[model samples]
Target chain A: MEDTNSTIYALKTSAGQERNVARLLARKARTIDGIGISSILVPESLKGYILVESSTKIDLRNPDLKVQHLRGVVEGSVGITFDEVKRFLKPEPIISSIQKGSIVELISGPFKGERAKVVRIDESREEVVLELIEAAVPIPVTVKADQIRIIQKEAD
Target chain B: MKACTVCKMISSKDHCPSCGNPTSDNWSGLLIITDPEESRVAKELNIEIPGEYCLRVR
Candidate 1:
């Protein structure tokens, strides 16, 4: 189980500068004590915001963290939970999570050792429509869900 | 089971099949990278490949 901290806060920063701010905070955290920074993240879909995990309430006004670069934190949005962040985390591949454009290597079947990309999925049938990536001509082939191993996901 | 010391990829073989590095059973973190392009965690870790990775391997 993950530790729970009530001091997690979200800070607004310059758009496209979350990475820089995170780096700065990490450096600053080494110098400070009592309030140590744990996790830091900048969601890809969101701009101008970064989540910070700390042991205690951070004095945003403190100059050590260089809060000048930070605009303001999201009030009432503190106490960020790991469960919340876990949702944004990359989900491991499962049978149902497989989708179109996912690259897979056949684990068992006539095309064993062959690599293919998912073109479609049949939920009721628990089968997938695959296109052989190495084939001279793109041809769609149907296979059972358990026949292939996921290489790259469609989301990637 | 063993973990690759190089890429932190978990594999049963003696060598890491991902990077061909030697494998060690001592490892932690079952990280899965589905999409590297839009994943901030992926960018932070400098991982470009979509596969299973570990946070730490020793």
Candidate 2:
């Protein structure tokens, strides 16, 4: 289990500035203890926002000094913590808490909130094999378990 | 069933060979390793052989 104190955050930057801002944040975060910077995600749908993981709450009040410096290199940054990042980088469990063929809600992705059947479970990758609720195709969709919340458990 | 004296890698060959430790059947927890390249656990556990692995030993 991850420590509750360990925070995750996002640095919202201009479209093209993700790489530059990430490099700067990585350097800055290392200076502080109880702080860490993990992976960065730039979704195609999201125009801005570079997701980052930090061990502590980030002070974004001094935008000009605290974030603006990196913003200058990038554009702008909105400091967000780990919990906020979970809405983006949902880490799913390696094992299903429910039975197979059960319907689980999609927590994140294009099919958010949509319930799908568990077709398979990739234990190694921690991904869930899902069959879309209203799809004409029978292909099983593999989605990260973290990105979903189990709504109802199917009977064995 | 033997335990490696160095890294504790399990082998069934014989004569305390392959990892230089006497074989022991006292292993538990089956760790299924399919892909070692992308698996952080496999890399961290230093398992090159693709098969079941013993997670804990007494």
Candidate 3:
């Protein structure tokens, strides 16, 4: 499990049954009062584990009847636990507009902090292809759209 | 230069309509795909026929 702003814990289960546990956990989480299911990324691997996204902390550590019931659902040993789902939920920053001739500053790359003109925009992937005017080669470059900040044009 | 959506090439308008790629007004950042041969992104992404490419287009 990944360790980031979100905490991801391990739940013991038979090999090749991680996906089943994930699905069952999602269902159970949904039924739990005040626990809202956000997203799940169940990879196709025995070592894989379920990812549950929620704002409030969950009580999956109970070793009582709920654990046995969860195990029965999977036909194997099971214990509901936590995994780093916060990384998956980390929000991507937003932007307003990207247009031609707009001045921008490169946030990352060999030309980090350098300014360039916005010649084209790829809205789908949220990246910008820029042409370096000050550089000797004046070559074009591509970078994530969030990497740049629009330079507000001033009155001529 | 009118950018070819598929090829990312900057060419004269009404000519060189990128025969294989896509075109759209939604392109965000304009980047020249210079040195597509040496560029890691170009090689990994299999982008050929260099030109202006939208870095991020909706």
Q: Which candidate wins on DockQ?
A: 1
Top candidate (lDDT): 1
Please list the residue runs of candidate 3 whose C-alpha ends up more than 4 Å from where it truly belongs after superposition. A1-96, A153-156, B1-58
List candidate 2 segments past 4 Å from native. A1-94, B1-58
Clashes of 3: 28
lDDT ranking of the models:
1, 2, 3
TM-score of each: 0.44, 0.31, 0.29
Instruction: Give per-residue CA lDDT, model 2, range A1-156, as digits (tens).
Output: 332233334456766655456555544544544333333344333455555433444556533225432443222465444345333332233364755777788888888877788877776666788988877777777887667777767855
Worst 10 residues of 1 chain A by lDDT: A86-95
Query: Which residue pairs clash within candidate 1?
Result: A156-B35
Q: Which stretches of candidate 1 lie over 4 Å from their true place?
A: A2-6, A91-156, B1-58
lDDT of 2 by residue, B1-58 (tens): 6554344455675434545555556443333333344333444456665443344332
Could you give candidate 3's per-residue lDDT for residues A1-156 as a string of tens digits?
A: 222222223344455665455556555544555543333333322253443333344445543215322332222354333323222222233443677677888877677899887777777667677877677877778887767877843223
> Model 2 misses residue B37 by how many Å?
37
State each candidate's clash count.
Answer: 1, 10, 28
